[model samples]
Target: MTHTENTRVAVNGYGVIGKRVAAAVAAQDDMTLAGVADVATDWRVAVARAKGYPLFGATLEHVRAMTEAGLDPAGSLDDLLGAADVVVDCTPKKVAAGNVERYRERGIKFIVQGGEKHAVTGHSFTAENNYDTALGRQSTRVVSCNTTSTVRTLSALKQAGLLKKARGVLIRRATDPWESHLGGIMNTLVPEADIPSHQGPDAQTVDPELDVVTMAVKAPETLSHLHYWTVQLTREASKDEVLGALRASSRIAFIRMADGLVALNSVKELMADLGRPHDNLYEVAVWEDMLTVQGDEAFYAYMVDNQAIVIPETIDAIRALTEIEADGATSIEKTNEALGITGRLVPEPVAA
Candidate 1:
């Protein structure tokens, strides 16, 4: 169905993902930022107000507190929902789960971040993997950053008919950059006790047929999560063939160590140089030069921008749940173009 008017989108948190979702919704020609709801009266909420996004409190008490703090919320969370056709709940882990009933009661389609379990939504979303399933649905959980990256790259290969089974190792960021000062691991690498960390099973929520397992450890840094994948191909495939498969998805951007992008920080620096908002890298930054293919195995690595990778997917999810756009590919293209997602971080060199 074609939407004549913009989708009214309200963001329920003004934190990392919520703020980005608000900006993305405002950026879309087919959507409008109805308002933002949050309990905080600090700098984050201040920034949300400064951006001119209508502000609402998460509760009546929170609204009173905001007024006391001079933040002047327009109303309560209920008011925000009344103005929005859909709401993206980017509240911290477990918090969004509590808001599910509120959203359902309002009959507003809602989206929860990956921190919430699949049972909360009964459907997990990654635009490339399951956009159609989410269309006109009441709610969906956009999988975690690691799972989002995993699905984007692996689904590319699976769609290309090169994947048989896959195993991955994840190096996770100990904490978010903003919260690093509060507390985080130092001089330590904490391994996840479970062999297949939650991300693997979570990825399966989007595609149950995937034969995938993952192990992970928390790293000291807060920049991004790095993943090393080892995949058994359906048959012997050449390096060129594997690269071609990965290149098919616009959400997977090719980065190279040869161009001085030797580490995660370097890729983040490149994003800043490219003038991305908050230096966000929405695509899975895969090392094209490092990807290798053996007889029936393909080994590669990529970086997941935990803070930013899922922003585009959330935008597409808003489109899907609202039925603003019927075709998945069309919504994807619109989102990519609006967010400036190219498949490569740098332009390919012209041959002499």
Candidate 2:
């Protein structure tokens, strides 16, 4: 295999996000999926193997277990890292932080998911908000799914000089759909213990100047997250102006309930109908018709595909860390093109 102009990317987990990241990385013209490493021999990891990603064990014990299970892993995690230019740590919460020392010891550039604290990388990333800060940097933490959508939407308004302060309520999914059978809430809601829940602060890590506060509660379903925001604009603005401001960012897509995307599940179904890989909704699905403006206040709601939203940001972060693309817009445009992320999902509005 020749490594002339591509960045070799090793993914540290093959779970929900890892599997998606692996696929996205393999789709890029300037990046290569070196392999995926995980301790499991279940269907998830098996799928990666089926897709022809080189397998690796996170530990010697894992290697033995995988071998016993007939999953032929190439080697340990270190072997995977040694073969790549950069690694994306998609391990579960707190686990990726523990792997940081290993990555640094090998002088490998790495990116961690939002599960870990900002202190883990000392710099948090959302492609549009902070790409240059991560340029040529050894490491960065891609903020979680919720934070990614929040930053993308708010940054759009901020850039247009329409943002003053935002107060939002997030109805979060209980768990990834794949893991719902394991354990999740039933017929009830679980609210985050604190007001201005951690998501608000997490978004701040990506853009500190944005005046935003959030409250979140977990719902029973796993389709996706719903965020309703009441934003105080810098001045009174019309719906079209606000929509245009949001439309400026390529990652924010407008979906209309009038087009039969009345709910999150409907939107997910649309993704499958559109032939999106893994039925992924890479853009923040803001309801175009549902948004309203009253004087200087604007209200809107959007759906966040928890499993898929962060995938693009992670892709952009890969380019930023590797310096494969110097301009953030170029990296975003390339990623969006490869992933088929047009600002509109349904080309023609469906008649209700």
Worst 10 residues of 2 by lDDT: 1-10
State every prediction's TM-score relative to the real structure. Answer: 0.97, 0.97
Candidate 1: which stretches are off by over 4 Å?
347-352
Clashing pairs in 2: none
Error of 1 at 337 (Å): 0.8
Count clashes in each candidate, considering only residues at least 3 apart in sequence or on different chains: 0, 0
lDDT of each: 0.93, 0.94
Candidate 2 on 81-102: residue-level lDDT in tens? Answer: 9999999999999999999999
Model 1 lDDT per residue over 65-167, tens place: 9999998899999998999899999999999999999899888899999999999999999999889989999999999999999999989999999999999
Candidate 2: regions farther than 4 A off = 1-4, 349-352
